[model samples]
Target: MKAIREARGISLRRLAKDIGRDPGFLSRVEDDKQGAGPGTLHLYASYLDVPLAAITHKEIPRDQERPGSPHGDDADPPPDGDQGSC
Candidate 1:
């Protein structure tokens, strides 16, 4: 994500503000330290003009967290063998 964003000459601050997110939050998303919510990912896809999947290949499946459902940021991390990490 960072690579693509940088390649497109978009600054993290600019993209974060445009997509209504904090730059630190976007940084974590790029680094895979946090899982982005679906809505947040959609905003990124729209702002970056890229396919959603391109940025969400490792996102939690919608079936696991229905759209609009809340995800606790501090929830227990996925198991070591789980499909969580990108």
Candidate 2:
């Protein structure tokens, strides 16, 4: 998590503000002392310019060249054929 934040040049305070959370709380989450709920993780991913799956499912192997891979050029689309923009 810290790596992801640093990769995007985001500070803890700024990320907390963007996600409507407290810096200390965010810190705990990053330190793995506390867990962020799915909703909070989603917000963090959005604010940090990361994919939700990256944080939520860390064990999953990513194939960057695949269309839906987080590291790929294509942004993931919603299921159910929805065309929602990220």
Candidate 3:
């Protein structure tokens, strides 16, 4: 997540503001000291123009979050023991 943000030349402050979150909160999320909820992840995906899987590393079931969105089953699941490292 941090890498993608940096590679896109987006500052932490800018991302936080765009996502409607505090910079400190986003900083903690980037550092792995905190977890972003599904709604927050959605915000990130929407703001970054990426799929939820890109922000979560796992596919959200078709019937779960995105409904008719393109990010279901087709996403590659994370490796063994992986946990939201996107």
Candidate 4:
């Protein structure tokens, strides 16, 4: 999560504001001390301009799928299909 945030160059405070959450709360989420709700996850994905799947999907082992490739099922699609545009 933090990786994605950094990749997007979004600060915790700015991300929190974009998500309508508190910076401290977002900080906790980033540090893995807190779990974000589905809504919050959606917001994070939207604010980062990345597909929610990129954030929520679990990486499967190569052995779990074809050789040399990780595969996993897509998470339930982002709640509203359209997370609010910035």
Query: Per-residue lDDT for 18-71 in model 1, tens only?
Result: 888999999998999998888999899888777887677655433334333345
**Full ranking by TM-score:** 1, 3, 2, 4
Tens digits of per-residue lDDT, candidate 2, 1-86, equal 76567655789998888789999998998888899898888898787666786766544324313455566558665677587658
lDDT for 39 (candidate 2): 86
Q: Please estimate how well model 3 matches the true structure, expressed as its whole-model Cα lDDT.
A: 0.72
Task: Decide which is better by lDDT, 1 or 3.
Answer: 1
- The CA lDDT of each predicted structure is 0.76, 0.73, 0.72, 0.69
Per-residue lDDT tens digits for candidate 3, residues 1-86, read 66556646789999988878999998898778899898888898788777777766543334343332346555666679778556
Q: For residues 1-86, write the lDDT of model 4, one tens digit per residue.
A: 77566645678888888779999998887777888899999988787766777666454222223332223344345568489887
Error of 1 at 36 (Å): 0.7
**Of candidates 2 and 1, the better by TM-score:** 1
Residue runs of model 4 more than 4 Å from their true location after superposition: 57-86
Q: What TM value does model 1 have?
A: 0.64
* Cα-based TM-score, every candidate: 0.64, 0.62, 0.62, 0.60
Superposition error at 2 for model 4 (Å): 0.7
How good is model 3 by TM-score?
Answer: 0.62
- Among the numbered candidates, top TM-score falls to 1
**How does residue 17 of candidate 3 score in lDDT?**
88
Give the residue spans of candidate 3 off by over 4 A.
58-86
